[model samples]
Target: MSETTHTAATTRASGPGRLLVAVYALFAVAATGRSTVQILTRFEEAPLAYSLSALAAAVYIAATVALARSGHTSRRVALAACTFELVGVVAVGLFTLLVPEAFPDDTVWSLFGIGYGFVPLVLPVLGLLWLGRSHPRTPDAASSAPPSHRG
Candidate 1:
């Protein structure tokens, strides 16, 4: 890759990006676990609830993968996934609150992510903001200058 591209890629993978990736990984694990337990034990009781859990798991998995990959494409994918996650959390939260019967059994968003200390409620928003602030690297002015030719 060209130096420009390399710098861009490196900046995109900065400390905040790594931190977000870590959080995404945690969500992946939590969502996977929640869905697996719901599916194995009580799927028959509330297919919709369990299915939603599975969907949450899938979203988190996608976010984790996308964030961990470095490139323009991966950044776009990660942004979209995080946005969708935010929407899902809000919509599911409201639905759970307004129509308790809709969720015969609790899924992850049973009480606006009360079970998860609302990290599910807040993480995506933070992720989006972080993504927005991330800038690709550019050559520093000093580095861009040609070396002086002295005797």
Candidate 2:
């Protein structure tokens, strides 16, 4: 017959998890501020870029929220947000390369996130990697069964 037991252990705070949270937070702030500035300063000059900036802000906000939550639900949301961010960066970067005039002003993703020191380009990649690393262990693996004491 199989036996089951449970024990207590203190899991250390995840360094990558914390880093992920921080990066997401930074994006949240940057995207929000950039979008606000663009919308207020010259929205008509580049409506597509400005609108994309708003979308970028929303995605960053969602990513931050998801990373902070750190549960099944939040993980899913984070995955989605990261995927969208990657797609957005790649698509926008390519578009800007192929169609220069199409983008009269800069958005968060313009020129592969050049304005943000490429952090915007790299963040989602790191986010996805961290997400994979932080994936929840299975029940058997996560079990806290006490070590056997037989000598």
For TM-score, the strongest prediction is: 1
Candidate 1 lDDT tens digits, 62-131 = 8888777767787788888889988888999999999989899877766778888998888888777776
Worst 10 residues of 1 by lDDT: 4-13
In candidate 2, what are the lDDT values of residues 95-120, reduced to their tens digit? 98899899998888988999889887
> How does each model score on lDDT?
0.81, 0.79
Best by lDDT: 1
Q: Which ranges of candidate 2 are over 4 A from the true structure?
A: 1-13, 139-151
**TM-scores vs. true structure, each candidate:** 0.81, 0.81
Task: Give the Å shift of residue 57 in candidate 2.
Answer: 0.7
